[model samples]
Target chain A: MNDMVKLEKVVKVYGHGATEVQALRGVDLALEAGEFTVVMGPSGSGKTTLLNIIGSLDRPTRGRVLIDGEDTTRLSASSLSRLRLTRIGFVFQAYNLIPVLTAYENAEYVLMLQGRRPDERREKIMGLLRTVGLEGMENRFPRELSGGQQQRVAIARAIASEPELVLADEPTANLDSGTAASLLDLMAQLNEEKGATFLFSTHDPQVMRRARRTIVLHDGEIAADRHGPAGDE
Target chain B: MIVRLAWRSLWRYRRRTSITVSAIAVGTALAVFFVTMADGMYKKLIDEAVRMGAGYVTVEHPDYSRDLSIGLVVTGISSVIDEARRIPGVTGIKVLIQGQAVISTAGGSAGVGIFGIDPETERTVSPLADRIVDGRYLEGADERGVIVGASLAERLKLRPGKKLVLTTNDANGELVNEMLRVTGIFRMGMEEADGFLVQVPLDTARRIFGIGPDAATRVGLVLASPRDQSRVLEDLRRRLAGTEAAVLPWQAVMPDLAGFMAVDKGFNYVFQMIIMVIIGFTILNTILMSVLERTREFATLMAIGTSPLRLRLQVAVESLFLGATGTVLGLLLGGALSWYFQVHGIDFSGIYSDDTTIVGYAIDPLIKNHVTAGAFLLVGAFVLALTLVIGLYPSWRAARISLPDVLRSR
Candidate 1:
């Protein structure tokens, strides 16, 4: 498979002099296209910082970050937004759906930003909702739904645009074990079926177990690189 | 969808918007009433002037209205009448013959100007028919009848069918006496007019003055419109060229009345400005506050790619929405009031029943204010435009809100 994302000696620094702290330091990594990869770390481990750099949500303070063979660290804000819209999809731990919009509308929001036609949105969004088991609950608001149901809606929203890369920041941090497993299973299924790359930042054992590839980081640097049950990596 | 969004936002602030709009409506309504009433009252003054001494236009024995030179008098009424009748827009003409006279009666008599007028034509031109509270107008030119001014008739204690001895100085320097039966009492409601005016037949005036049937002191020409008074005077100057008749406007005949209109117009404009200044600030204050409150929403919209200028335009739209609705409501109410007043004029009967003179025009003290649609629309538009323009500052502040502050706070 093609390499979907590559990072080389990336560093993110905050403040200066006595107040300085480094968030990411000289970390290099790559993941194959259409792979389900999970980065596991304890608190303050820079897993989210790495995920943010790879997802095109944030840029590195030093070194180069490449996605689909183009250097994203150098892109301007507008260009970065365009890249995020066309290529990268983000699923936050909090769901982060607009309070006023319903489940179906929340899923429809990303596609709208991409300027997709309503007809195109209707077909794709309906299919994704069905796939994520939110078929009949499309009109319900996030506040009105169960935590598990809302998470499914968030996952459905993240993949609704058929983006090439999906970055989930602490996807199962707020879900029950059973719901977390089911959500991870759904993401794994989508990653295989659609050739869509999935990368997640999580401390959950179940998520780490389900991931086909795992990267372990400690104190802002890579601690280990490990593979799934059969030792593919 | 943009319009739908704007509409929804407005509905969300219905109470506040309505209050602001109502304020504008009331302001516009008041402005409409004031402007139209001032305009109407001023027009009425001109109409009364037309009804009084000065005809819409005057043709003289050339030097009459000018230096009042008696030598320039027109010699023949027949030719002057024929020439004046052919003048375009000259509605009517009347010959006025006046001379000083004294009378004796039980109530006491005073000197007055005795005018000679054709009874038939006089009925058409003067309001003499309306003023006959106790008697009838002179029957005809040869009826040997006379209409005395109310105050003059009162002074002489003369009643209809009573005979009064009239005396006038003739052209030959002889005093002439004739007996006239009181026919009607003419009332203009003016102190000077009521005290001084008396009407007699043309033949009687000629007989008393010892002049032939032809000569008269002045010729009066009534025109189609009071606005045409000056234009008619100009035409008379050209038409009666080389004649001794002094072509003059009523402004020349009665300079005080013309000065009254000028002063009234100036005061009206000053009052209009003050009203606008006081009310315009109310609209501006409401609109400015509305913009300041919607800062975050504006920032989100701009972050989503709406230009700053378009955001400002949205504020303007909101102002127009408020202004237009209020204006429409005020117009409906104000128009209803104006119509009611027009139908049943307000009466100053109680206050001025004893008689009062206002700026030299004898009128009721209670003046009803009338509103016109044009005035309503103009004031509404003026206020709306003011509110929208003032909204720009707050809109700009909203558009400039930074995204980091909003999302970070989020």
Candidate 2:
């Protein structure tokens, strides 16, 4: 499998001096393309930080991060922004869609930023919304939609551009169990049927069970990395 | 897309946007309205001052303005007036012998300023022509006819048909006197003019004062517009370069009035600036609040690969939109108000008596508005630029938002 993201000895420290807390302590991780992976840990275990670094949303304090074979550490801020624009996508736990834009517009934002033709953007966004079971709710604004529907739009946005990697940080944390399970299944189906890679950080066992590969983090360190059927663990 | 986003974002808080726009519009309208009214008042003052005293552009002996000497005279007054009349902007020309004299009757005597004017031309240029309250104005053939102010006539206990004697020195420094009949009485509502001024027929002064028929103390040129004063002055000076004539603008002739107008205009500009700055701060507060409330949304945009510059541009565009809308609306409302006032003046007679004057120039109590394109452009540009400048801080704050921190917190 092609390597989608690789990190070596990445460290993230918060605060300064006596108030310092190490969120990620010299941890190493790699994600291959088309891999349905989950980074599972309790609070403050650096799961979100790892996703941030892998998504190029945050720079590592002491280690190198590679996205699609390009060293993100050496890239300038603008260069990193361009890399993130064309190569990576993110889904936050809060379903961070621009409130002013409709669901379809929110989903089409990345493609628009990529300068795609409008018709192509319309086509892709329509198909993605349908695949995420939000086909008829394209015109609804974020405030007009429920939490599950908003998350669905966010997922469609994340994969709309066919990014090399999708980093979702507890995307289903705010949803009920049924909704969360449906979202996880949709993401898994996207991963398998469309050959899209997804890396998520969640404490939800549903996500871990749905994921093809699960890496367990404890206290800013990887305590275990496991693969195969989730039931085997 | 940026424009669409900015426009939508502005209307998201419709009440806030409306409030800010209203503040700017009202401030700008007040500035425009008051400025136009003040300008109209100034034009009236300058017009009355120049026409009642020296013309808009004057040609006199080089030292006459400084010394006010009867001996100082434009020797070739006829040619000076002729040449001035030929100038493109010179609409009317008059040759006058101006001097200090004393008027006396059996009851009293008072020091006065005498103006010898051609009655035919004075009718077109002087406000006094329209202000005769008694009898008739002087005629070119009535060399013995004189016009006395209402206050002066009262002090001298005279009537329209009364006789008075004007005593002054001739050009040769010999005592000369003339018997003058009060053909008219004029009330200018200004004490200085109404109490101390007398006008006589040009021939009578020339014959009595021993001035040559073709020579006079000053040659005054009336212009079609005040803006033509300088050009006509310059052209007159250039045409009469070798003569002892000094062509001067009315501002130079009446420094006190000029100085008053200058200081008044300065204060007006400062007041306008204060109004604009206050409006600018209102815009700043509204935009800053919008930015603060959308911290997480801005962070999301940044995370979605919008450049910091783009985010700043969006904010700046919002400010521009707000400023443009307000300025346009202000111009329309202010223009309408000014046009109405221009046609129907604001009556200030209750606040000010007809005797009110500024720098010895009589003031009209009914004030109108005068709108100039320059004034409109200046106020509009100032407001728009001020809003843009104030937008900088909020746009900077928008661009500088820390994505990771905001996302983590929100």
- Per-residue lDDT over B164-250 for candidate 2, one digit per residue giving the tens place of the 0 to 100 score: 998998878898888888999999999999999999988888877788887888888878888887788888889999988888888
| Per-residue alpha-carbon lDDT of candidate 1 for residues B1-410, written as tens digits (9 for 90 to 100) | 34444555566667877777777777766766667676566555565666555477766664465554323456766777787787777787888765668765666767877777777777777665677877887766445687788888877888888887877667676777787788778777877667887778877777777767677766788776656666667776777777656777777777787787788778876787686676667667776776666655554444333455666677667766766777777777666766676666667677676346545566645565545556666666776676666666666665656443442233
Label model 2 with its docking quality class. medium
Q: Write the per-residue lDDT of candidate 2 for residues A1-233, one digit (tens) a residue.
A: 77778889999998899999999999988888899988887898988888887877777789999886888999976787788788778999888899999999999988888999999999989988887778789999999999888988988888888776788988887778887776677777778787778988887777777778988898989998988535568
Candidate RMSDs in order = 8.1, 2.8
| Cα lDDT listed for each candidate | 0.71, 0.87
Off by over 4 Å in 1: A1-233, B55-118, B121-128, B142-144, B161-181, B201-254, B365-373, B400-403
The per-prediction tally of clashing pairs is 6, 0
* Native-to-model Cα distance after best TM-score fit, residue A46 in candidate 1, in Å: 16
Among these predicted structures, which one has the highest lDDT? 2
The collision pairs in model 1 are: B60-B245, B61-B244, B61-B245, B62-B244, B62-B245, B62-B246
What local lDDT score does residue A151 receive in model 2, on the 0 to 100 scale? Answer: 88
